[model samples]
Target: MNPGSLLAYRHVISNAGPSDAAPVLVTDTFPSGVIFDSAVGADCTGGGARCTIDRLAPGDVITFTVYGRTDTTVRGTFVTTATVASPAENLYPDNNTATAITTVRIFVYLPLTLRSYRP
Candidate 1:
């Protein structure tokens, strides 16, 4: 990734339980050095800061695509995290959270000045 460049990320959430999971909510906070842009998916909302998914069901798999741009001065490693939860107890909570990392490099150009002297 490069500074001022657009970046896209995807998050997948699945209900592996035998029973349905209702009123599910999925959230992802924008990582530092990146500005939120937009997202797409079912029941998806929120942009320019975070993303949210409103519901899910047993054996349901949902994919979310989030768009963002790298800050003009951003560099180094950036990590983004997403989590899924519901008021109902999750039989397996270990897979509720996911994370992704990206490296950014910025290129800068400087002008050179030259002068000639006569003896």
Candidate 2:
């Protein structure tokens, strides 16, 4: 992504349960180099860091699309982490956290240099 460009991230949350899961909440903390732009499939809060899902049925998956504006003043790889949680107990808690990585490219304009003139 370039500076001041829009970067999009998709997060998939699944309910691999034998029973229906309760309301799920996805919280994503965007890196410092990105500002929260907008989101879909879920309601955003905490400056687009937290998203809420009404509920999830068994074996159902919900995907949330998050948008962010790349900060023009920053560059390099920025990491955004999203964590999902529900009131119901999860057997496998290891996959609760996910990360999205973004690398910002800054174009550098250089002036023409005259090293040697052989005219």
Candidate 3:
């Protein structure tokens, strides 16, 4: 993504269990390069860091779309993290968190002048 451009992040949460998971909570932490704009989802609210799901049955899936704008002066790469939690007992804690790394590409424009001479 380029500087000052809009960026969207999609997070897919799935329940791969023999039981239903209730009261699931999803949280995200945007890096310095991203200025959080908004979020779109069933239980998502205003702002940029958290989402909630009342319940998720077996083989059920939910998703959240998070939007943000790239900082004009930001360069290089930035990292963002998202995590999910539930009241139900979790066997694999390692799969509860996800990380994304994004690289920013910048373009510079310079003024050009043309000169003419009489022959």
Candidate 4:
């Protein structure tokens, strides 16, 4: 199988409040087809929640949506910060440039495994 055909999935983590954040960095990248289907903590550092997923492939679209509980104080936030590498590989363009993933909406409540082709 081609590496471009692999599926990668990860929970985009970052600090949020008001002012500038301390920069919640993502060190590793997920392989294509692997879905992050489990509840994860809102903490900058991954903890508490279980990070689990089935699997997926590239070219697949994983949509995310978020909902806040009634008693919850602060609403949960989700963000994606990844850029497509050079060569202008296999990617669907919205206008002209590579697909810009700003944020995945958290609607399912539970953590979901999202799949995308690896390259």
Candidate 5:
């Protein structure tokens, strides 16, 4: 990704339990050099980084997309993490958290200086 460019992230959550899971809370924080833009799916708030799901039935899957813009002056590797939780205990806890990393690069060009000499 380049500086000042848009960066998008997608997150998918599924309910694997046989029974319905309670309301789920999904949260993500903008990484350094990133500014929140927009989000799709779920009731997103907190600068489009937080979402809440009323309920998730068994075998139900939900997807979310978050958009952000890179700071024009910032360049480096930015790591963003998202986590999901439910009021009820999750049968599988190992997959509750996920992360995405993005690297921003910028290139610069300089013109050569020339001088004229007279004899």
Candidate 6:
């Protein structure tokens, strides 16, 4: 497939309210072990005050274009960790801690075509 035609997308699924929270996207290539791109707090997950496929809530889904373009096809690992803030009544109100990571899902989105390398 045409690398330019392919785009990367992502979303954060949670069971809480005010889905306005921000989401971060990180991409890492395998074998070579490299991070091609990393976007922090990208508001591309919902449409308004939201971005991506749709307005997502708990069990909802969304998508975004993380890699707008590429010259070749490669394999990599995508790590998604949802940084959330706990309520004041919770044990730990601050969501910056490790325990606050609510949802994390990883998968591979392949382009329409694959590029081959010659030995």
Q: Candidate 6 lDDT, tens digit per residue, 1-119?
A: 33323334343334343443233232222122212242333443321122222233434434433333333342333232233332212243354222111112233486697789998
Error of 3 at 108 (Å): 1.5
Per-candidate Cα lDDT values, in order, are 0.72, 0.83, 0.82, 0.27, 0.82, 0.32
Q: Per-prediction TM-score, please?
A: 0.79, 0.84, 0.83, 0.19, 0.82, 0.24
Tens digits of lDDT, candidate 1, 1-119:
56888887787778876666677776766667677767776445555334445556677898878777777778788787778788778777888888888888767788899999998
Q: Which has the higher lDDT value, candidate number 1 or candidate number 2?
A: 2
Across residues 33-80, which tens digit of lDDT does each residue of candidate 5 receive?
A: 777777888777756377888999989999988787777777787788
Better of 1 and 3 by lDDT: 3
**Model 2 over residues 13-111: C-alpha lDDT tens digits?**
888887777788888888886778888888886565778888899889988888888767878887898899999998998999988777777887788
Instruction: Order the candidate numbers by TM-score, best to worst.
Output: 2, 3, 5, 1, 6, 4
Q: Per-residue lDDT tens digits of candidate 3, residues 1-119? A: 66888778898999998778998988778787677777788566434567888999989998888887877878888898989999999998899999988888777878899999899
Q: Of the pair 2 and 5, which is ahead by TM-score?
A: 2
Task: Report the candidate with higher lDDT, 2 versus 4.
Answer: 2
How many residue pairs clash in all the candidates, one count each? 0, 0, 0, 20, 0, 11
Per-candidate alpha-carbon RMSD to the true structure: 2.6, 3.4, 2.6, 21.2, 2.4, 12.2
TM-score of 4: 0.19
Task: Rank candidates, lDDT, best first.
Answer: 2, 3, 5, 1, 6, 4
Q: Residue 8's C-alpha lDDT in candidate 1?
A: 78
Instruction: Give the C-alpha miss distance for residue 104 in model 4, angstroms.
Output: 20
Residue 87 miss distance in model 5 (angstroms)? 0.5
**Inter-residue clash pairs, candidate 3:** none
lDDT tens digits, residue span 19-103, model 4: 3222222222222222233333322212212222222233332332221112222223323223222222323433212122322
